[model samples]
Target: MNALSQTHSQGVVMTQAYLEIRDLVKSYDGKQQAVRGISLDIRKGEFVSFLGPSGSGKTTTLMMVAGFEMPTSGSILLGGREIAPVPAHKRNIGMVFQNYALFPHMTALENVGFPLRMRKTPAAEIARRAAEALDMVGLAAFGGRHPREMSGGQQQRVALARALVFGPDVLLLDEPLGALDKNLREQMQVEIKRIHRELGITTIYVTHDQSEAMTMSDRIAVFSQGVVEQFAPPLDIYQRPTTRFVGSFIGDSNFLDVTRQNDGLVAQGIGALNIAAPSQAGKFHGLVRPEAIGLWTGGDEQGHCVLSFLIEGLVHYGDSVLLIGSAAGLNLRARLPSVQASHLHEGDTIRIAWRENDMHLIPVQ
Candidate 1:
């Protein structure tokens, strides 16, 4: 059992993780590491996303799991068995790439059944299973259609059906919807989630899109410079991020440098803040999400900090408005509902307030 499977502080014995990645590292040149020491423990039937920007090792790590790239060091255990030495074809792992990787010449049914045919399955069973797979992805009628005849979304569904026809032990998706338009990409996300729910397959998704990861995954591993910075559920990662990078990368944010001043904390250039201080009482970075700040309309300001915000810019997004400006030498951004900010304009000074509980503190690194 891995360390994560041990009994918790509450004396509950945790179940063993289905897949365990330990100290996985990859480097093209021995001197320069592309993937630094990375580790993750994923439970069975869990959808986990490796989220990061370009050259951040999210894709490299996914390739390592798919057996497309060899790791210079570390172990990948699936169902408690080591698979690092296993070849790509022998690992029984299915992968879908960003480009869809469909065979243009083959019909949809033929493409979906290709994996089974490679295994020398009976012709009759292959046809039946292929049809079932196509139907599962809502493409049974498109069986006779070739890749060129189908839309981008339809082609992606065919690729998904093909990957699952073989019933691989694990499924890895590397930005499968990256090529589609915004609306179609969102449609595919729902389709992928529905398919995952039906199969109960342990899946790993790699994407640089923050919203995609937030919407799809049961848990997310935020990757930066080849290292796993924070791995947690979506709400925890958003509301109580362990690091400043996780906060800034995941969404729009305003970071304030704060120092402990005797009994309370004082933000640089903003004077004393009323938010609760951390246990250590040292220099910290205070994160206040834009949506947390609201327009103050002269009421009891209990447990809230108020500021006079000079509106330098206003962005209208139909449902909401974003105000960008400085307050007492500190630049901040506040997002409010369009109805509340209907009369507001750029260059207007307004009173804005945020709840004390909404501020998250991170240790300065």
Candidate 2:
């Protein structure tokens, strides 16, 4: 296991971890490492998402856990026992991929029952369980339909039923819903989250889509370069990211360079901030999420973290309006509710403010 995974006092072992990934490392060309020394413990019944950009090693990490990719160093524990050298079939982990990978010749019923049949399950039992799984995915009526006969979303659901019928220890998803349209993708996200909540299956999901990760994962392992930058709950990762990359990757944020001072640090163009966070001399980044800063239609800049900036633009985000403002040589992003946004417009003098603790410090390297 990686140092991070071993540091946990209690490794989650549900009905046997469904799956455990420890200190995984993978290199494609021998010199360039794809997956750095990464480690994560997926609890039996927990939904964890590996969210990162392409080539950031999220897929490789999942592959190593599933025995499709071998790690140069470290061990993967499934059911409390090590499985580094075990074959894929022996691992008994269910996997769902972006490509449905269903057989063109077989109907949905046959595809869903293939895994069970491979294990030589009784014909009667296989048919019964397959129907049940198909029903769970809302495809009971389309059992005889082939892959070509089903919609992208329906086909993906058949793939899900295929993975689930066997009741494997862990469910691994690698961009399983990427093929669907946006609306269908969103619907699938909710459907998957609902299924996970109901079944409490230990799941390891890999995706470069941040919104998907944030919406579905119980916790997220934010990967960059080749190593895991930070592993934290979604809210914590978004609100209080430990690294500059995490701040930039997880959500929408406005960053400004600052110089540390004894009492309060001086921001680039917004003047001094009265935040009480730790300060260093050289270079630091002040991160403020759009929601953390609100557009001020009329408020005096008496408190800390408040500034006067010209409203540059506004983008409506359904529930809230994103105000693009500028002040102190910095571009400000403030999110206000629709009601507040109605009162403000582009090119107006807009005031911006945040709480002392709403601002955080990340020493720039």
Candidate 3:
């Protein structure tokens, strides 16, 4: 099912679409399509992210929506009106590019006021609104400084302020935090989310970073090879991935090839696993998250599938440690709390267990 079809089942209400993309297609040559006939319905004031690797057509789709690129044959509807023929300048959409596309010579205030000046607003009103926009981004005092004088994070805030000063109906962010260092990138993520919350504008964020998309989006569209693998909320995409690509892309996963038998379902080396998922008849792959595996010290193993584990390597990640090992002739990765793993070492033999319902099933594809 597409993202929209799964929303109601997940208890999320579907309101009228504020931005509708119908069979949106884009092609350079007549033969190969960069973007296939993709469709989506986005509600107003929602934060939706387009997530994928490079050359996945996510940026192309965003450009088409912004009127920077025309669609080959499709419709882009905004507020129930078709806008595929509209010019970029007339669309009234705010855009923040990967690089903060600010003028080197212009002061921060002038950069923020450029949009209003284009529409021929009075000079005094431009100054007042520009100042307000700067203050909104927590950069009021830096207005006098040129782009060269500020830090990377500060320059990005200026770019964002400039985009919002005119109050555009939709905000499109194309990897706005790509240039910043890790700490600053995380800081900007929080700041941008805060601003989006306060303004409540319909937002389309484009990023290749899965963690960033997971943190900020109300829903994520996972694109791959000119199509969306799955578009759903963060947890849904992680817990119930509809495709093998999605299962590996979102987070760490271990997939086991399994088959159904007359007695029950069984993997090649790992005997019958007590998976309590809904029945779907066919060969399937079982998804087990590293953190879902639990260490069994002893006693009654009740309500768990116990298995022997041979530890081969260990990786310490401050709060948690990852145990790389072999279980039932298949490679396994298990995550444990730092305190619980303090005494564990490579070449150790141990027992691990996981609940029957914790094992998720995905059809082989």
Per-prediction TM-score: 0.94, 0.90, 0.92
TM-score result, candidate 1: 0.94
Name the lDDT value of residue 327 in candidate 2: 78
Ranking by TM-score: 1, 3, 2
For residues 316-336, write the lDDT of model 2, one tens digit per residue. 988899888787778878888
Q: Rank the candidates by lDDT, best first.
A: 1, 3, 2
Instruction: Write the residue-wise lDDT of candidate 1 on 29-111 in tens digits.
Output: 89989899998998887899999899999999999999999999999998888999999999878899899999999999999
lDDT of 1 at 157: 94
lDDT digits (tens) for residues 1-365 of candidate 3: 32211322222223333789999899999889989998988888889999999988999999999999999999999878888999998887889998999999999999999999998989998998888889878998999999999999999999999988876777899999999999999999999998887766789999999999999999999998888889899999999998888888888898888788874788656677665434775677788899999799788756666789999999999999999999888898999999999999999999998775677788886
Global lDDT of each candidate:
0.88, 0.81, 0.86
Off by over 4 Å in 3: 1-17, 276-281, 301-303
Question: In lDDT terms, which candidate is top?
Answer: 1
TM-score of 2: 0.90
